[model samples]
Target: MNRETLVEIKNLSVDFSTAKGALHVLRDVSLSIPRNRVVGLVGESGSGKSTLALALLGLLPDNTGEVSGRIELDGENLLDVPPEELRRLRGGRIAMIFQDPMTSLNPVFSIGTQLVDAQRNRHPQLGRRELLKRADEMLKRVGISNPEARLAAYPHQLSGGMRQRVMIAMALLCEPDILIADEPTTALDVTIEAQIVRLLDDLRADFSGSIVLVSHSLGLISELCDEVAVMYAGKVVESAPTKILFGNPRHPYTLALLACEIDPEDEPGEALVTIKGGLPDLIDVPKGCIFAARCPSRFGKCVEEPPLCEVEAGHKSACWLA
Candidate 1:
């Protein structure tokens, strides 16, 4: 079976109205998600990871000033699709598992009800009983025991891990072609985080869809993603296969990000590695390489912005040095 591009993003850019100026959230970003592959988006808090995700789902905030780009799903540009078609595609062809399950799940409804509602978009012909059965099986698949009773419980009734599991079950219930998990393990304990990671790993193997893991955890990205895209400020500085990116990153930003990863087996009392400078101001982004200000290897040629270009087969980087 050919693993062709399932979703293709080209020159995607987004800006928001801010008191200072137009805050460029995403800047000429382009990426490809191959079928059944796991792609990771790694960046800092303000790197616009979530914004990009929301943009893909056509869920950008009302404050968004401008959005220009082509987000193609199986060759169809979703950005140009009608509102009704886009709405149907949001949870039907594409679905998302937000960072905080507690906030993503409704406190007022039982898990069963929410799960059934989630399926209605994709399986409108299925009856309530059938949806409930499917939801029950999905909950069990996500490692939630006693699915029947758990379905009847509200989001507040479950533990943090359980709530996250419920969120996963709900997203899966949609039978989407693409699943976007935005910091799915955020705020969970070490044990629960590990569980969620393992669960995702298991699902990626069996699920017939591609996944986008939006996370700050390099460790997680290195372990789970087939490909990795590194973002800085509001642009993708580097992206490549997981091994290629981690083994031999081309951009300074990617190198700096790898250097900041915590090594569990390191010598004791070592100060935690940290990136030097903070993110650049998106309102007035630097003209040259976004990472040049803090890049230790900066040179005179970096004064002008570098376009993301292929430096090697199947690898691309946006740095003059690359």
Candidate 2:
């Protein structure tokens, strides 16, 4: 691992044992998030984006799911750490902002109580009043006006955007070294989403910490991420810097994704390109390339699983064509 790397996921895999059999949710997913850099994991729904995030935090469901390989944070392997140590590292060293803020926050308790409890979890010595003050400050930092009034309100009392801001505030209260945001702006409007993105960028600049943004929108990733990883069928097909990946996408899957977008430069009568066929089921993944069924450039070699190969400097793709 590099000395400057904040998080290193090496050959990570997650499996879930169901009544039918073992289902692979992630396979040999390796990634590195350097300190203070923004890494975006972009994929369609059910591509194991959220699963990978949950696995990194050691928060996967008990008994049903199994996580293997290494997850190193600050040169320490998180997978090998004991449950007690992992628990302490979760909120103190690493934090998560889930997609749905309403469900993530308790409906029964006031926002202030939830934030105070979260703060106390990381700093046990902090008194209730001090925690409350910190929570209010965090709320304002996240762009929530009238934080004191908002603190007294329950989760149900706030709008979706407000609740999301509250969630961000709660996640930042501990000033974690790494922040895992799983579609943090999914519930907000475009304007609010932009605000949230800007807020996260500003926070990253201020805190000098790494961020792992899990989203399906390539546009958002292009805007906020320094690096991008494209996942299809539970495995990454392409990994490259944001500019290079968007400028000249090499993998067929990546090309298809870009073609699907409606560019302003396209002629009025031009037909939009869409990748045909649905994503493969995780319960029974294909032995060969999972995207081969949907890929337009598939050949005989595509029937065999292709390992991720370097196509260009700092660019890797898992396709025979690449």
Q: For this target, which candidate reaches the highest lDDT against the unseen true structure?
A: 1
Model 2, 196-277: lDDT tens digits are: 8888878876876788999867777888898899888789999998999999888888887777654634421122224677
RMSD of 1: 2.4
Q: Give the TM-score of candidate 1.
A: 0.95
Query: TM-score per candidate, in order?
Result: 0.95, 0.91
Off by over 4 Å in 2: 1-3, 63-66, 263-273
**Candidate 2: deviation at residue 84, Å?**
2.2
Candidate 1 per-residue C-alpha lDDT over 10-31 given as tens digits, one digit per residue, 9 for 90 to 100: 9999999998889998999999
Clashing pairs in model 2, backbone N/Cα/C closer than 3 A: none
For each candidate, what is the lDDT?
0.88, 0.84
